[model samples]
Target: MLQKFQVNLMASKLLWTIFMGLLIPTSYSVFFNTTTLLEWSLFSISSTPIMLTLILDPLGLMFSCSVLMISANVLKFSTIYMKEDKFINRFTVLVLMFVLSMNMLIFLPHLMMLLLGWDGLGIVSFILVIYYQNPKSLAAGMITALTNRIGDVMLLLAIAWTLNQGHWNILHMWMLDENMYQVLTITLAAMTKSAQMPFSSWLPAAMAAPTPVSALVHSSTLVTAGVFLLIRFYPFMSSAWWFTPLLLLTAVSTTLMAGLSATTECDMKKIIALSTLSQLGMMMAAMGMGMVHLAYFHMITHALFKALLFVCAGSFIHSHMHSQDLRWMGNLANQMPATSSCLVMANLALCGFPFMSGFYSKDMIVEASMFYQHNLLMVTLMLVAMGLTSFYSTRFSLCVVWGTNNCNPYIYLEESNPLTSPMLTLASMSVISGAIIMWVAPLKQEMMLIPMYQKLMPLILVLLGASLAWLISATKQKNESMLMQTQINHYASCMMWFLIPLSSQFPMKLPMYLSHNYLKLMDQSWLEALSGQGINSLSVKSSNILMSASKPMPVNYLMMSSMLGLMIMMVMF
Candidate 1:
């Protein structure tokens, strides 16, 4: 009966997930109309509205919607994706955990609950990352998990700082604080969680997981956790003088770095992986500039387009016997029409093509940046990032979909096979999802613009980027070099590394470097040394010291005599 209950609980969780996605929206329609009842959950018990908040704020609504939709879709995909895998039960459990955590995260009001959700999300992601449990994949998962844990620590410090300042209940109340320590800690937490700067390396490594895992977790949900955190804590971030500039610096560095790295990547997944980071950096920049809504709006659209891109890439890989190298892939449009079409649509969204969901959010961010102080430089850097974004997105789509027909000699030796109908279905949804996002209201704010041409700047950047990409690719088609490719792949890293020398001038540089590399090594070494000598050393030293200061123990007869003497004395008393 207990075993049955566990089964029931697990099954019910999935049903709850479906309800959270579909039934909640239906419930909203009803609750807004005829229902006088207010259904309270843990979320309600914690949430206190001090500002002009909707019954459900737009950010929460959009995020919850995305959470349900993608999770449901991922569940559908995973039913097949994990079919042959031995760890299916564990996979399902983690997926359920991820869904539950993400839902709670969107609705969480206090910092404590938000941290709980954040850690839960991290655990689920780590489990998903190492699902197969191979050495390389486990290493990848551990690195990401460890890095995220570091971010969590900084976040905890920030929370303590906030509570000390008497911002006890409302974590979102940022401007109320005048503390600089709180500001630095929070900024550090955000940048690390978002995988900005040196922390960005783990994301590409995370592509070692399954394709569905990559699509939903890395591309859409997990990688966006930091960005979402920024959106949630936007009020607090703006209160800090150092916050915006730091955020902007990280954003630009990451954007440029990821773009350059995307160029050199051979694995299809890593290219998309780097691209996700680049796009996320841009979103972070927008958030730092006080465009909270715009940041989340882009995050939503990015989830749609980037997820589709990954699913499509997965289909491409599955079709060709799990080959992830784009260089070996060519002329797939003729063979995998569904996938090609979907790739094209997602690319359009990614390139910020006009009327697409990508265009809407990207424009809002750019507009926010324009309104930002020092608009010219920020906008230019963003525009440059935009160009890189377009170039990489286009390159990713085109190389796999319509590049040269000739397969590499190495690939031909392996004799790759074509994809199946299931793969085609996966690709189909990715394409259709992009179109679906256009109808999502918060992101489709084109009508709210001040003037038609006011929005033209972002469009112009998109055009310039696309045109330059076309020109570069065209030139490359004449003579593509492996050297150029190598440089392009390492472009993001080079930029990040460039910061290391500059960072050397700061007082914290040595500690940061040691913490990043040597501290963990020393920690393990210390543990080993202590463990090896601990028991023997304690036994020898304590026993010798005690013996030197004490007499030998009395025999059993002496103990008996002492007891008799005590009894006699008691009798006398």
Candidate 2:
């Protein structure tokens, strides 16, 4: 019965994948051939006058199509990746729920309705992050859920503040007065979900989840939620003075931090997770620069290759008896040819190698940054981040694909169709999606005359980064002193400069300390003494005293004396 159920579930997912494949072309038509906005009203509350509105435009259509496409592939991958687990059916349901939530977020335009989907994503992600039922998974789930909850709170506040405008639908409120607080709140909320600086610990910690979950959540659905929200809310924010510089700072910091951390990470999954963070930063940076379309384009391309990277990494883990440490992974190109090839392709795309998926969007973002008159420091940081991206991608490739083979002799290292199939599908997209998006949804670039070197700055950075990585990889094997120094330097990088520990600890400890004090001083001492145990003890002591006093008097004698006194009193009256 169990086997039959699993088979049926897999079939359902496969059908969904086919449906999504068809929907992609439909989405392309809607994006390029149609300009009409579709809307439907679910219901409206007359009291507070909040309307639940669903709006589908080209942007939403594009995002929805991407979500469905990636989701279908993830579900298909899960069928094989999670086949050995006892609760595979439950996992499938959670993934489908996650997809549904993302769809709701994509399709809905009302702040009230979007909240439903936003909150759903947060709650469902928490459940999925903790799906493994272990301490680490539980801790990660807490971080993931709590970090996202901050965003949820911000959205709720935005919704509440916007109630004064008498409409919950942001699309309908074009002329509504823009509130800086609301916009800032929403932007910060988006930052939290995107795992920007100060809230980035949860992204890597969330790798405790199963890899298929990682592939889905980190790549297309969960992390992108913030970027999508910003894209939708961009109109209201474009003119805000603080919006650009704030977003620029957050994005550049997150990009640099994540890239540096990725370079030092030895855990294969964490490296991929940090790379996702870095890419998300790029997307956010583009949005910050007032290029929503470019950010959206990069977002779609990143989703394709990042998901492929996670699936490939997952395959490696499964083959290597669940070990994710990169030190144990080496020369996989020989043993697992298909998986290794996919890894290389994804890494190359991540590094923004010429003409690849990342190049099409990332190159434009770099160029756009240069074309704008921005702060020199911010631009330099962005360029350095581009370099670090290539540096880390090459480092990861060297460690996992071409390093020494360290697997146990008896362990089988072979790629299965279930794993490689989804990877190949995504790899194909990784090759072509960039070009297609550029052709179909091209961003209008400003005409500027500049030196050839400026146009090729991103490529130049890539070469410099790749060369640095090669030098490090080549020399580390021969130089013990250099390796030691590298390790010393890596201490800060590997610990993410204590960002995770400090963020996790401060938030966790402050609340815990307050709770402990509340428990000890209020619940255990004051409240108990005044309301609960103290009152009970006082009543019990009073009753005991009354009983002891009454026992000293005889009932009959007391009654007779009382009667005599009553008669004397009546005569006197």
Candidate 3:
């Protein structure tokens, strides 16, 4: 139908219209400090009420608006990006469902109702990740699905645990007592969803998906669901003494891992995916420092710029005939000016440059780190991770966008308005959204006291990271001299400290090995001896013995003599 009518682009227009329709009210909700609580009992089960509860608040509405805006642009972008795919309709529907699931997670206050979105993300993400229908996509999809399944189970456990409270609304769970297990599960669920530490492998592997799915999943929908869940549950989960410390460790480790991984990665989409992971760590770090609002603010800002970054990256891939390796992407600046320009701004925003979208929230979090009392080691790691963020972003931009021509000099690179317009829209947001949100959003005013040096720490880290990147880029001679060392470090970094294998193959290998051994022990050994083979052997031996009796008449005679003897004994009695 889309092929016949060419309204392949109309869905995005409709979505954009809805976005414009809701933007005013959502902004009003933010400015006027308005929130609405809506509750309706859907049904009763065994004296328990199943309710559909929605929170029409600044945060929910604002986030919903962001999701719609990004989705609309992504859909428009996909019309051109996926123009040649045979199953474009299927892809469009899947993307719509993905957006719907995220919106559900954003608004629903009820835990049970929230699961509809939470699990929907997991299921739909797996499908999108493997949409290419290849072994690599399948493997990546498996890692993504299994890792998220951990969070899904944790969420379900939280819902079951809270069922005893007679209400499933998470809004009121803050006052309830003895929520230790509940908070722990909620934290675990959030960590896995956001791809922190042990669950970090899937985020990068999910780059096997199409660039559009990566734009959505890495930006706001799938990966952000965890942080969003944590934000919602923060009121109750923060009561635990260990909450901050746990998240602190998770954030630092994940940031370090992703930053290092991005520096060495050659795949364009994976590089951006790793950046998303690093930003998520920053968000988690903010929450860990007891700055929940800062974390949420960072999440929102990150979503905008990250989505923009992915769209720009997607355009690069499309121009190069779907080549995503950074090594093959240089000299694109002159060939594709619009994409190159948007890519530069996206990277700038990602680095949290002054006045960019990321600066408002990210800089606050950086300062708050100094104000908070997380141990010396945690603070150092956090600062180092921030520096690494800038380093990788700079390194990536230097390698892919501004480097010398690495591909065919005469290759055609198309930059249509339909393609460039989405990046332009998101790029504008990436620039101005931070300042607008800072002025409009009514965040709690925290009185922060820090020395001038401490206040400059984040900027200093950014400068330092960029310097290191430039230094390395200029020092290629020394790097080439230590080729073996360079190769070793690159391999390790590309493997993400061996996390990719551990998460993807280790889980599969161990289970398969164990099942193989179990088969050898049970089916091949004991079961053969005690059940089928053993029974067969016994019956065979007995049959042979009967056949060895020489004749059927001899066996019949023996049976008759035994029966006659028993009859004589009965008569004597």
lDDT by candidate, in order shown: 0.67, 0.83, 0.86
| Tens digits of lDDT, candidate 3, 396-514 | 78777777778867667898887988999999999998898888898795789999999888899999998888887777732111212577777778899888787777778978998
Best by TM-score: 3
In candidate 2, stretches whose alpha carbon ends up further than 4 angstroms from where it belongs are: 1-4, 11-33, 42-52, 175-178, 446-448, 478-489, 529-573
Which is the better candidate, 1 or 2, if ranked by TM-score?
2
* Per-residue lDDT of 51 in model 3: 95
Q: Give model 2's TM-score versus the native structure.
A: 0.89
lDDT of 1 by residue, 229-255 (tens): 777666766777778878887788788
lDDT of 2 by residue, 1-573 (tens): 654576525644664665567475557655665544555655555655555566656677677777777777777777777778988888887887888899889878889888888999999999999999999999999999988989999999998888777777766554335587888899889989999988999999999999989998999999999999988888877768888889989999999998888877778899899999989989988887887888988999999999899989989898888899888878888888898998999988998989899899998888888887778888899899999899888888888888888778889877777777788989999999999888877466666666798998999999998888889888777211122356656677776777888888876798899999999999999999988598788757855666666655588458656765786588579
The residue ranges of model 1 lying beyond 4 angstroms of the native Cα positions read 1-56, 165-168, 171-178, 371-373, 406-455, 477-573
- How many clashing residue pairs, candidate 2? 0
Q: In model 1, what lDDT does residue 78 have?
A: 56
| Pairs that collide, model 3 | none
Considering every candidate listed, which one attains the maximal lDDT?
3
C-alpha-based local distance difference test score of model 3:
0.86
